[model samples]
Target: MIQLHDKIFKPFISSGELDETVSNMVQEVTKDLAGEIPVFVAILNGSFMFASDFLKKYPSNCEISFLKLASYEGTSSTLKVKQLVGLNTSLKNRTVVVLEDIVDTGNTIVEIADLLANEGAKDIKIASLFYKPEVYSKDLTIDYIGMSIPNKFIVGYGLDYDELGRNLPEVYQFYKQTDK
Candidate 1:
């Protein structure tokens, strides 16, 4: 268990589980990207940890870049996305792969995809470490999903709360334990 702010969260996803899932997903990604060299655009901050694992395991020849986007303030999404930094690489006529830590409301992903498309990316693929399908409201499809979780606030494995808990090796979720 871990504490972030006033909340206590219990272990949700373990480190071993993360390694196994990422290993399996790498095979699928390699097969899907057999003939092309894709450019991986990793969303910054929260995605740094996931991207470190995923990109290391992704066998396909690819280039990597980063874009920083912010939307969440604490456990809730502000629903208003902002770009803290911009993309420097030219995505023209290239296959682009976007790696995200989590996809919730999908506002940020949609916005990034639009910009990439407008810059002439030939194809775009989205990969997310975690997905909350119940609360996902965007039309874009997540091409690679590590896991589907309930609509609960979680932290760890690069995910943070008010800039804490990102260093944890496993995921932690809000626990509703009570003592009488």
Candidate 2:
């Protein structure tokens, strides 16, 4: 359990479950990019841990890069995406995969795809460790989805609350205590 500020969070996804899910995701990603070497552009701050573990499991010939984007203030999405850092490589005619920690409102994803497209990326795919279908409002197809979960607030394995809990090996969700 993790207590941050006034919130109490209990373990939701254990380390074993997370590893298994990531293992399966790696298989799917390899199969999808079998013929092409894709450049994995990891969204920084959140995807650092996921990207590290994913690349270790993925034994394919690919390139890795990092770019930082922000859309969240506290635990809620601000609905406006801003790029803190830019991609350095030329993605012209290259297959690009956007690796994200979570996909909620899909605002950040839209901006990522648009930027890649404008830079002449031949193909773009979205890969995320977690997704909330209920909250996703964008008309975009998430190519790789690790798990489908509710819109509950979560933290761990790179997901953080107020810049904390990212080092946790497992994912956790806020627990509400009602009067009994």
Candidate 3:
């Protein structure tokens, strides 16, 4: 168990399960991309682990890049995205894949997609490790998803609370405030 924001979160998804899910998702994405060599754009600060794992399972050729965006004020999102680190590569006419740790409100994904489009990316797709359907508000399509989870505060596998607990190998959920 781990503590965050005065809450205790028990382990939910184990490291093995995360690996399998990411592997399957990567395989699917590779099949979809087929002959095109897509650019894997990892959303930084949260997707480092997921992106690395996913890339290892990818059986196709691709390039990798990083972009940093911020939206969370704490456990809850502020629903506003701030571009902290911009994209350095030219996305014009390139096939771009945005890798994310989680998609809750979808605001961050939408903002990133729009930016990529404006920069002339020929195609844009999202590959997320987790999806919270209940709170997801954006109508934009998510091209690929690893898992759908219930509404809860989650950490680990690169997810964090106040910039902590990201080093855990498995995913955990905060069930009570006292645990933290």
Candidate 4:
């Protein structure tokens, strides 16, 4: 159990499990894009940790860039995605893979894919460490997914609550006490 700000959280996923999931995702990507020399665009702040682990285990040549987007104020999404930092690299005619920490309602990633497509990216792939299928409403397909989780507020392994709990080795979901 852990507390961040005014919320209590309970253990949801272990660090070992997460590592295995990431490794598997990387392996799958390598198999499909070994010699493609894809460009990996990591969504910043929240994706820092996942990007680090992902790039380290990726056994191929790839270009990397960061794009920071914000859609959450606290534990919930504001539903308005804002690009805090823009991508300087040219994605034109490139196979771009988007690295995200988590995909919930999918608004942010959808917007990113659309922008990359508009910029002339030959192909765009979405890879996320965590996914909330229950709440994901977008039509975009996630190329590689680490885990499919329920609609729960989780933090840790790059996810956070008001900028807290991102350093936690494992993942935790918000805990609500039942009044008995």
Candidate 5:
């Protein structure tokens, strides 16, 4: 177990597992977007590691950009999604794929999709490293999912607890027993 601020997290997903998942997702994405060069817009901070690994394994040529959004203040979501950094790239009439670290409430995904749609994107697809279907309430579809995890707080592999544990190679779930 590891401590981040006042919270403790235990190993959940290993580094190898994450890598394998990413590789599989890349294969699937490559097949679907075979002819067209899609623009990958990665959500910043949490998705930095996943985006890097994903882009590195992507076999075909693609354009990449980043947008930073925020909703979480600690272990819980603030229930408000704010776009901290806006997109500068022209998404007009382009096939755009959004890369996210995790999708639970799906508010951020909704916001991004709306923004892309307003920009007149030809098509929009959402890709996430981790997904919690139990808590996802958005009508939008997540096209690519690396892993479907339980509704639990996790850190590491770009996910964090109070801005810590992002450097950890493996994913860790919050340990309820350690809260005391």
Candidate 6:
């Protein structure tokens, strides 16, 4: 169990499970991009750890980059994606894959796809580690998904609450707030 801000969140997804899931997803993604070497653009802050693990099992020749976007304040989605860091490479006629930590309202992924399209990327694929189907509102198709989780606040493995507890090895859920 992990304690955060007076609340205790039991382990929901262990590190081993996460690794196995990622490995499988990487295999699927590599198969999908078999003919082309795609440029993986990782959404920063949250997807950093997931991106690293995923690239290890990708089993293909690909380039990696990072794009930082922010859309959350605390544990709730603000429904707006703020692009803090921009893509430095020209994606014209290039196959690009956007790696994300979680997909909630789908605003961030949609925005990223649009941006890449505008920059002349030939194809765009989205690979998310976690997805919340209940609240997803975008019409875009996610090319790859690792897990579908309930609409609950989660932290750990690069996910955080109030910028704390992201370094935890496993994913945890916040059940409820405790009295301080």
Clashes per prediction? 0, 0, 6, 0, 0, 0
Winning model by TM-score:
5
Residues 106-179, model 2: lDDT tens digits: 99999999999998999999999999999999999999999999999999999998898999999999896433
Candidate scoring better on lDDT of 4 and 5: 5
Question: Largest lDDT belongs to which candidate?
Answer: 5
The lDDT of each candidate is: 0.89, 0.92, 0.91, 0.93, 0.94, 0.91
Give the runs in model 6 whose Cα sits over 4 Å from its true position: none
Q: Please give the lDDT score for candidate 1.
A: 0.89
Clashing pairs in 4: none
Question: Model 5 residue 48 lDDT?
Answer: 93
Give the CA lDDT, 0 to 100, for residue 8 in model 3: 84
Q: Write the per-residue lDDT of candidate 6 for residues 1-180, one digit (tens) a residue.
A: 777876778788999989988998899988888989899999989988899999987887999889999999888889888999999888999999999999999999999999999989999999999999999988999989999999999999999988887898899998878777
Model 1 residue 137 lDDT score: 92
Clash list (residue pairs), candidate 3: 6-177, 7-177, 7-179, 7-180, 8-179, 8-180
User: In candidate 6, which residue pairs get closer than 3 Å at backbone N, Cα or C atoms, i.e. clash?
Assistant: none
Model 1 over residues 14-61: C-alpha lDDT tens digits? Answer: 999988877877777888999999899999899999889988998767
Q: Which parts of model 5 are misplaced by more than 4 Å? A: 177-180
Better of 1 and 6 by TM-score: 6
TM-score of 6: 0.96
TM-score for predicted model 4 compared with the true structure = 0.96
Instruction: Give the per-residue lDDT digits (tens) of candidate 3, residues 32-150.
Output: 89999999999999999999988887888899989999999778898789999988888889999999999999999999999999999999999999999998988899989899999
Supply candidate 2's per-residue lDDT for 102.
95
Rank the candidate models, highest lDDT first: 5, 4, 2, 3, 6, 1
